[model samples]
Target chain A: MLDSERLATDSKPNILLKGTKEGLLLLLNEVVSFESLLEDLSTLIHGEKKSLFEGPDLKISVDYGERVFAASEIREILDCLAKRENLILREWGPSTAAKLSLFNSSRKFGPQTLLKGTVRAGQRPVFEGDVVVIGDVNPGAEIVASGDIYVLGRLRGIAHAGFLGDWSAIIAAAEFAPMQLRIADIVSRAPERDGKPLRTFMEFAYLKEDSMAVDKLDSLHAWTAMARQSS
Target chain B: MGTAIVVTSGKGGVGKTTSTANIGTALALLGKSVCLLDADIGLRNLDVVLGLENRIIYDIIDVISKDCKLEQALIRDKRFEHLTLLPAAQTKDKSILSPETVKELVGALKELHDFVIIDCPAGIELGFQMAVSGADRAIVVTTPETPAVRDADRVIGLLEKEGIRNPHLVVNRIRPQMVKRGEMLDIDEIVQVLAIDLLGIVPDDETIIKNANKGEPTVMKPDSKASLAYRNIARRILGESVPLLSFEEAPGFWGKMKKVFGAK
Candidate 1:
């Protein structure tokens, strides 16, 4: 075999998939490019299909050493792995010392999408998990997150949190005058306040007794505390 | 060495052909060599609107089918010395020309002209793809209405997806009276909904029909607001920062009195 082919088929592949107590830990070679790493990982999973996944389905966690990836890039890697039916991606993050502690504490955290600029009109950004927007959601834009949504700026567009019927998901923003808001299956329109100045305050929306309710975010800590007690 | 711009409106009758004609004429008037390609095959109207329909001996189909050279298909406009038109074949189907042919034709045209303005078809289909194939920039035209604005929004989204960044918007046929009466959507609302840079605003003018029927671009008429608007748009396209034209009419006696007295 050629030298490159020999290196490619070596026992210590670029992607190391080992069975661990925490299910499966996917350790990627930091030296390889991201694209090549993905290609090798795909080939490895497909090549070792029967023996590697002979038992029950298991969650696979990826540990990338010292490399930081954007939310979308990480999601793309996880999605590539998810195409294989035998593997379920539970979580993946940089294996920094700080994050390693969080990995040990909780392993059930799902994906989250973080968008930095204003979501403009005609732009629809959909996320599978929690979404955090650093800027405004202008009218004619829409954000659909399967989990909670937190916007650092004004929300004037359509925001659908708990899109998959998770009623506990909440929508929070610095300013909460949205054209239309939806939490799960329920839809609500912003009430018209003619001639009245809009309340310039932070607000959050959640389902209270099966009805959508908007509350001032000033008491957000108390609200979460109350919810913790109720749950 | 010329820029190719594709003028498109996802929904028809929002004035893509008219805008292309006027902008091309305006550019040619500014001493730039301009070629307007009518990409709306089987439904070509740019030639008719530009008043060069009778002068077309070889169409773009002839040029593409190798029956004629690219220069043979180009018809010179009598009004503007620098202006030229490549009329589409009315009898040919849109499928006759693929995106590759358009890219090749535009590449050739770019070497001969300062600007190659393509008039795209109505829908987001093969025709639209062919028109925008070699375009370095895009111009999306829409009227101040909900349906037009909605389609323009979709077109802008598609343009961005196709890697056409910063597609300029031309809100056409805006009625200032209806806007003041709150019956029609305003330019600001349309611009807000489209979320694109404002290129120009053409007021609803009967002169457009009169000039178009005469096979003349409205911009050639010195007194027409639509003409002035198109000129400003051409200037803007040439990297000149021109203030957006106001469509509002001068306040009348009662309006001026109300303004002076601070009355509603």
Candidate 2:
């Protein structure tokens, strides 16, 4: 009888509930309307499958694949579960795409953020696209950009370019004495005994062979020209 | 109204209380009416540093709680006629005084004095918040050490976030010999890192400790290097443009003789 009931529920493209070692996994359908999902969830808990959840307390983890659940939508799902006293929500796992979507919705890419004056210690300025600083980035400050990062003055702190994983992005500064550099997924720290005098010329950091490499800014023009000719 | 400057360092043992006592005393010696407010609460040391602990009948908490009048809580300094101290309470914690209460107290003190110097407690907590709430400007004190400069940078960031822009930097306890040996961070390095205007730099002098032990501000001793630095800072605060003092050691007998003979 339980197999037949599961067969009946499997025919519909709605919520899929499966038992695992961690207790129960509830996979909510992404294409179905949220109202219908909630209705189907309530009916399955209170209707024919009621006896299945009648045992001891069972942990339930929700996996909303490619669907971002709003607070109200989550509360509705919780309300549907609250009808059954034995079911407990142990985890909420949102899809990676959905998590990235949430961040993308807040900040738009393509445009640069221009910051004037020094970015002192404890100041972190983050941007979706390129970031241009007109002044110094002092020690302990951080600048993060989804694209390139350009500092007109000293860049002595941490500068993370291509924070969203754009490997083509770069970080350039007038005096490059950074504590750390991150380009895309690559990270590099300044060598110990970095007490050398400030460089006279501008320098930049880019991802080379899956590692961060530094070179004088003059080399970037030639590299870009070569890439343009090759393409 | 008078200006209120809060002396703060995010790290302890960087001489916030000592700087406050000395700066306040230096300002008073310049003929300005100065009120030094000790906001450390349970760990009050500004009074003892000023040697006015025995004269404190009431404290800041007494004034804030209305247990005593503001005038009654202020202890007049024995040496300086224009200097007064509003001691911190010993038993109560910093939570006893809210930022609004401190703002009000500082407002009242500003009306009666030319400068209200608040000695901030260490660390960025409620105590630091309460001390910073009443100040019109800030004086960030730091030593030449890396940790001290880092902490000072953090405090300067917080002060800027609180809308105190262009806060002055006072690099204290600078050992000239170490700086000359390239073993310590020099003034230029610290100023470059902090990117703030240098108000003054106080040299590490044994006389400062001796004077502090004797309940006398180093600024009172006219011959001490630290005293001269503090006086220059006070003069600058009074809108005087004194040149920065070079930390070079005083000339020896031969150097002085060469100068007397007009020889290079």
**In order, what DockQ does each candidate have?**
0.13, 0.41
Query: Which tens-of-lDDT digit does each residue in B136-241 have in candidate 1?
Result: 9999999988778777877777787788988999989988889888888877767654667899998989999999999989989879889999999999999999
Tell me the docking grade of candidate 1. Answer: incorrect
True contacts kept of each: 0.18, 0.65
Per-residue lDDT tens digits of candidate 1, residues A1-231? Answer: 225875876656677766655577777887667777777776666554536754578777788877667688677787777777777776666663333544443323268889986676578999988999988787778999998899988787899998988877889998787888899999989898664665668899988888889999876667765664465
RMSD to true structure for each model, in Å: 15.8, 18.5
Query: Share of real contacts kept by model 2?
Result: 0.65
lDDT of 2 by residue, A1-231 (tens): 235775685676587776655677777888778887887788778878878778999887777888878899989888888888888877777643333333443334589889988887788989989999998888888999999999999998899999999887889999888889999989999877467676758999887668877899999887655533343
Candidate 1 chain A, poorest ten consecutive residues by summed lDDT: A100-109
* Residues B1-264, model 2: lDDT tens digits: 899999999999988898999889999999999999998878988988888878978888888888889998889899977899999999854455899989999999999999999999999999899999999999999999988988888888899889999899999998888999999998898998888999999999999888788888888889988999999999998989999888888899999999999999
Superposed Cα deviation of residue A112, candidate 2 (Å): 0.7
TM-score of each: 0.70, 0.75
Query: Residue B131 of candidate 2: its Cα lDDT?
Result: 94
